[model samples]
Target: MILCADIGGSFIDFAVVHPDGRTEHRRSVPTPLDNAPAFIGALVALCAPWPDMPLHIAIAGVECPDTGIIHAANIPCLQALPLAAHLHRETGRAVRIANDADCFALAEAHFGIAKGHRNVFGVILGTGIGGGFVLDGRIVPGLGGVTGEWGHAPVVIPPPVPLDQEAAETLVPLFRCGCGISGCLDTIAGARALERLHLWAGGTPQTSRAIFEAWQTGDRQAGRTLDIWLSYMGAGLAHVINVTGSTIVPVAGGLSNAHALVDALDEAVRARILTTTSGPLLRRAALGADAGLLGAACLGLDIRAQE
Candidate 1:
């Protein structure tokens, strides 16, 4: 058995992966914030169902790249901490750690829709927008893993929204955002963006799904905001698409659930393409919520086979 984990801002998912590629057991727990030690301690408890050493561990989490220093936004207590080293010492087994978004891309490129594609871009459109690239199964870890901060890419501010508002969006950005850009595509196109748009249009703030519901029903405010959000997101994505020319761009995350918005996003992406007849096709992730854990397993499995 191999212990695989995907640690995100909110929850930590664990799975016992067998040699045959089956998940024998799975567990989930709230992520520990503010105290790395406490978080690791809780992790130890979660591992009780699986033995140590005999079963190797693999991990992926959201963190700072250069040092593998975990940022506290999701796991607050883990900020500036060395997660890879600590896990290795605790498990007393070979451990591999990558960022959560990177893991998502790897899983998709290796076994999901992106399989066999030479250049693959995996994206997440949830709380924030993120991206990861894989070429022939090797992940490109630019700037030590911050390469996929695509949502922070700038777009021209249009009328109605003032320069100060746009500047503030780019200046402070959302608190605790990894990209550090205020008022970014992540802030405007993600689930939170949908809720805020609802309030801005005089609707009681509701869930992203609700906004999608309105858009589907031809609610004018919802339709306009949704279009704006997709255009911005697509604009940022176009820069990547034009540069990499990746045929397959898998978009995951919370907003991926918005079918109506996703349809509009597809149209928006099509409009921005510069020179590709192949054209990028947007697809939902096949791994679902288990992508993180399964991806982490692939890391450990690959390493164990090497040894």
Candidate 2:
């Protein structure tokens, strides 16, 4: 059995995957993000009982994915840490470190929505947005190790031709995003974006979850926020579709739980695209949250195949 793990800001989840791809004995624990060594110590404690067990690590960290330097935003202490190298020394086993989003994309392409597509872009809409592209069955994470950083794309929804001041007033101080930017597409369209609009409409912050709930009930502000998100997302995706010409665009993240949102997103993209040859096949990621470990398993399987 191969021990597979997916580390997130809040939790680190793991399971054993037999050679044929069956999962066994899954578990999760809160992450202590003091630094790479401390985090590694925690992981070591977690794995102490299983020392003799065969383990191959696939990591998603805030580091240079190619160099295995952990420079992730969530795990800022991992910056400049030789994560892969340390894993090899401490565990005496092979380990792989990649951006979490890229791992998710790898999972989608290998066993989920992006399967069979030569060129695919995996879009993740979660606490933050991330995108990753794959070609010829391999993860092609671009330079800056941020191929999946599509969440930070700027949203420029210009005023109508006459530039009405009232309409411009409707677009007041946008959300301050994690990327420290104002009016980011993710900031405007993600869960936080929904909350901002709902609050602006005189809804309480406690009513945040109710915002999505209200979307189901067709609340005006919720619907408008959803619609605006889809519009901005489509505008951003148009650039991706034009540039990469990817065959698949799989929506994989927390937002995927909302079927109506996905439907609206697909419809908006179809309406916005400039191409006639074909619409980019947009799919909700079927792999859900297990993608990190599954894709890590996929990585192990790929390496074994090469050997």
Question: Which structure among the candidates has the greatest lDDT?
Answer: 2
lDDT of 2: 0.71
Q: Cα lDDT of all candidates, in order?
A: 0.68, 0.71
Candidate 1: lDDT of 34?
A: 69
Please report the candidate that would top TM-score against the real structure.
Answer: 2
Could you tell me the TM-score of candidate 2?
Answer: 0.84
lDDT of 1: 0.68
* lDDT (Cα, 0-100) at 264 in candidate 2: 72
lDDT score, candidate 2, position 29: 82
